[model samples]
Target: MSTSSPMRTVLVANRGEIAVRIIRSCRELGLRTVAVYSDADAGAPHVRMADEAVRIGPAPARSSYLDVDALLGAAKASGADTVHPGYGLLSEDAGFAEAVGAAGLTFVGPSPEVIARMGDKVAARAVADGCGVPLPPGTGTLTAGQAAEAAAGIGFPLVVKASFGGGGRGMRVVGSPAELDEAMAAAGREAGAAFGRSEVHLERYLQRPRHVEVQVLGDGHGTVVHLGDRDCSVQRRHQKLIEEAPAPGLTPELRSALSEAAVTLARTVGYVGAGTVEFLVLPGTSEFFFLEMNTRLQVEHGVTELVTGLDLVALQLRIAAGEPLPFTQDEVRISGHAIQARIAAEDPWADFRPAPGTVSTLELPLGPGIRNDFGLAAGGAVAPEYDSMFGKVLAHGADRDSARRRLVAALGELRVEGVPTTAPYLRTVLSSASFTEARHDTGSLERDWTPDPADRPGAPSGTAETVETPTVSSGTIRRVRIATDRGPVEVAVLGRAPRSGASASPSRRPGRESAAPGASGPGGAGAPPIAPMDATVVAVRVEPGQEIAAGEVVAVLEAMKMEMEIRSEVAGRVAEVLAVPGGPIAAGSPLISLT
Candidate 1:
């Protein structure tokens, strides 16, 4: 094994909460930190917190965060000797890691060869099979025709997953053969857009499995140790929403097996720095299968830190600087329970649609056992160009129940205005009976849970506050906050109530004007189909005169890298299809006119 050179300065080649998180660790280690940002994040908290900041490019991720040349240039100009790809963007890109090494800068991760080998799911499966790690039955990368034939042999209820990349972006679950073609096409498109590679493969879909993962660290000196495990089954749309440490309700034997498997894989790959090996645990059985390994620090690494009392980022920095393992597996210990809830700018009632807006009011919870790692502040903007998640709220306690309750209390104390957030919805999940009993699996949230009616969109809760200010025009506009039996509700009195007798038109929500002259009311027949949020049109599946039934997808929109199907709310004949693929669209802009 080759030793890396000493590192004095590090450049965080990412943005948002992860950047801020890496910067914090660098500060503690007395290492200079440089932050790179796009035009959209000039005033972000990470930029201000870093020792120095650089402007890479425009707001689009392709132009800034994922641009390898831009990141290397920023590292060179900022006098950074090391580059830390924090969990997303080009974090797992083998090309980026190789580029950093070619530029004579240390990449704070495993070698490029390891990244490439493990990044491809098909190849990783072979590696696991060789190591005697359990793996699900799956096929290698396939073309469209080959995939169709393979699906028949593999049978129905299979998963189509991108060969490269993680984060649930290019994944689709098909229950029958009829859905295979469309699912494959959509998955390929998403994979191509997110990662440079679009190749995909098939795997047997597990039913109601628990998403569990083991956190492992290596020092490249033939030393690898597992830092316990995490349960991330509380998910929506296949993305994890809540995570807990020590993976509550795991038997000692199963936990030991998972750790041993993770350590074995890391040793086989000659892994270095922080990484996670994920697995799917079959409910009511001891069967578990390897999912994939993340080559960088995970988003839920903090949960491991809370339970193990180790600063994983600090360890990553030390390992990159050619330090040997300071402690062995026998010395590692786990204590206390920790739960992390992701706070994203999305509306749960609107199918978790991305809701981007300026932060008008920001109040994070503070107390014993509560930690908030936030990226935005009051007056900061949650831009539509990136991931909707801006922060995480974590709670630690003596045990699982205590930790869960503390997290629930912390979420209740949290407040974010100006944009819809997942806080209320997350609070509901944490308090649910399934969660309390540790009976919730990966599919429970989508299949068994629904948001409380009080937390629905436009429904007033006790915590709801006026988020927008009415603009003063020629006519008087009055804003009032009334205390209601449910909660406090805000109302805008437009134009002095129409002078007590003159015919008045129904007031519309601020900034939401009718898209067309003859458009019907919201969700009614003959209404023009409007964009639910700011996004890019990925495809238009409808044309003029095409008949569409309610709940039928008319188009697909890409926002924050997540694809959302734009479904018609009422049955109607399309009068005109206004959406063009690859075009930018704003919330409430008409996409299709229906008659």
Candidate 2:
């Protein structure tokens, strides 16, 4: 009888890696999936993987994913019965959920009312307090004079938070009255940019606290289950770079207390579907303070799944379809330690800004206990229009030490050749004594640490002075063009899925972008990887089979964008031709190979 019922079809109103992650889960549960993308993402990995894809609008996220009409239109056109707002953008938008539900399509998340309530940090804290859950010592936002009074009562170190904040965007720490106003202004501006409204709240700031969160799953039937906890203290600029489940230093009693607090909050609101309740753990002290609730799936949910042996995305599907909570409290247990590191298309040396351009080489580590939640592929483009994260490298181990060591080894072997990524930076942090000993806090990344030689990619002599954006013309096809420091480089992509090995055989197809030739000659300088910034190969002195000594200059390339030369770090004979002149290239494409 159940088989006769109509099948489930979900329209994913988002793009990038999360879209791919969600689609994979929907597939395992026998659901047909539709993907919606902006003009910029027509060739994105997510679009190609879906059964059907619809162009919602232009490149900007607000005009597309956050656009209610566009999302609804795509769902209707694709015959979608549900809309899965995969984290960020419209994920927590109550209005979007209401719109989808009004259109008679299920929203694969919690109720609209629940989203609204959880969004207000003030209200969320109130609920936690009411339910006997311990909370931070700060009340709702008060008048400016009241704020000063409250600050005094809460003590000097306190946090001013935007009522609607995520990604640590609208938070300011004030240590004294002199810094309070400035913190407020910065918090308000950032909050407005990220969440639109700038309403603010207050909380006492605990120095050196560890950021921890619990994953909660609930069904409308009143049964809610907790999927352990994740330690998310490894950060830079308040953005998490590494996360792990079954936190390293937590005692059994502490874990139970934290998990119960998360479960209690869900039951308080009759919450439905997947959500995370975050808290700030005072490391030395066993006590923790309630931070806020994320009413949507988090970016780090994979760690929880690895430790608990549950497919959260699949669980979301079952819950959205009105299924009961599959397991009881006793049944849900953390089996092992799991760790995840975000591999972003950004330069850690450059204040962690997004490094957007073509991806010449895209490869990931594969083995036992490894899981990759990725977005980019070879020949795909990384745009400044969205986040820099290309994927997350996750590994599970029987214990914390094994997980950390295995994770570090996997990261060392991982490579993304096109744009600069945080892979090398991740390795540095993982091997550090502080991290290895499990001593970490929210401020660890910002603390002074000697930069490893490997961590620093030498400053270019020069590159990318003037940027030229390349364009391709085709009637009726809207395109996204990027102006690189180099000359205009045209990239035409197939948004539709390739026949599995299309990229591997790109050489046969020809005309795709390739980097300038590598440098050669004295000083044992061999240009190993060609820099992507626009420049001319002013000089290519190395030939095939040339014996190169260490630190020799193999090539001298000029990027009128900026003029620069690359030297090989390895000592060997030239093995192959990696780049060609008069062609565009990106960072890390092999220019020369040495024996």
Candidate 3:
């Protein structure tokens, strides 16, 4: 094993909760930490928690967090001997890792070669195949034409996956051959934007498969060990929302097989540091197929920590410092069950739309077996230019049921105002029978889950319903319902009074616009399509005089690194196009006019 100089100061190359988590671990190890932030995150909790901070660039990730030169510059200026990449951004970028090594700064992960090999879905498939590991039917990297040709052989109901990155950014599930082309295009665009590589591959879509992964740690000295398993089947749009350790309902033999396969794969590659070998398992069967390997720490690593009582981050630092494994596979012990719920700034009632705003109130649940890893605080901003997730709530217990109950209670106690959150929806999921029974799979959330009526904005009791009153010459008064522990109460809010004989204009907030008289807006006759949120217009699919049908996509908007297709609700002729590609547009802003 190659030896490196001892590290003292570490620079974190990411933002939000993961950054804060890494800094805390470093502090415990008596190491100084340097935090890098964009303009939007200057006041973020992670910045305050670090020993020192450096502003990298503007709010956009491409200009800041993902900028290699800026990150390395920060490391140099801060005199950090080590760089710890937290989860997303450029965490798994092989080029970034190589650059850090070239700059003589230790990267707290595996080798760049192993990262590049496993980060590519196609190449990892070959390694798995060589290791005699089971794999789903899929094709190698392909162009548009090759993808179409392979789609026919793979049949319908396949997934288009980005070859270079994970976290469900560059992935699309096509139900038929008709959707293959668009799926591939979208997946490629997203993959390119997120991972800096557009290469994609195809895989046969499984029916309600369980998403399971084995966590592996390796020392460059040829020692590798598996840290049990985790079930992340509860997902939406291929993104994991909930994760639990000691994946339930796995037969002993099947569990052994998964561990052996993962350890073998990691050892074969001479892997170092922490990594996860993901798999897709057919429910109620021993059959499993290799998914992709995340060459860095996972977002749900907290659950594994809760069960195994090990700090994966500290281990990564030790491995990077040329330390050997402190324990063998036999010495590792898994105890109890643990569950984690991701708290994101999204509106579950609106299909989990990203809802970024200032946090007016922040209250996290605190109690036994509950841990809250949060990045934002009261008065902090949730920037639209980054990922929506800002915090995670984890609960550990003696059993799965106990853990589930604790998480449910924790979420119930959680509160965040000013921005919509997924806490309520997550609570519902934890309390759902599908989850409690371990019957939910990767597709279950999209297939069977529905937003609780009480949780909707304008639902009946226990909801934040809006009641409009008669308009006066000044303006209109709206009563907003607020649910408290006592009961629901209506609070009258006064709007800005308009000028004499003038009508009120819509508020500039996203998704809160009031359609103007004879002006196009959502659900208005001859109204133009409006942007659903604050985003950059990626494409304007429609032009003036173009006839379109209801539900036809007129534009594509990119926000928080996710693409949203803006569809028209009423069929009409396009009168005007207000959105320009690559331009910023506010929520509720019209994208196109219809006549």
Best by TM-score: 3
Q: Give the TM-score of candidate 2.
A: 0.76
Question: What is the lDDT, from 0 to 100, of the residue 151 in candidate 1?
Answer: 93
Candidate 3 residue 503 C-alpha distance from true site, Å? 18
**All candidates: TM-score:** 0.90, 0.76, 0.91
Model 3 weakest lDDT span, ten residues long: 482-491
lDDT (10s digit) by residue, model 2, range 1-595: 1243344798998788899999998887778999998988889889999999999988766788778999999999999998889887888888889999999999989999999899888988889999998887887865456677778788878888888757776687898988887677657756665667677877888889899999998997989888888999998757789999977788888888999999999989989999999999988778998988999899999999898888888888788887787688889777879999998876565345355667877778888899888887888877655666778999999988888888998887786666667877888888888888889888888774434434554332333321122335321111111122222121222222112112211111112222112222111133243333333354455889888765566555432112334555557788875556544444324456666
Candidate 2: worst-modelled 10 consecutive residues by lDDT: 500-509
After superposition on all CA atoms, what RMSD does each candidate show versus the true structure? 6.4, 13.1, 5.7
Q: Candidate 2 lDDT (Cα, whole model)?
A: 0.73
- Per-residue lDDT, model 1, residue 10, is 94
Clashes of each: 0, 21, 2
Residue-level lDDT of model 3, residues 139-191, one tens digit each, is 99999989888989998789999999899989999998788899889999899
- Whole-model lDDT per candidate: 0.82, 0.73, 0.83
Candidate number that wins on TM-score, 2 or 3: 3
Q: Model 1 residue 263 lDDT? A: 94
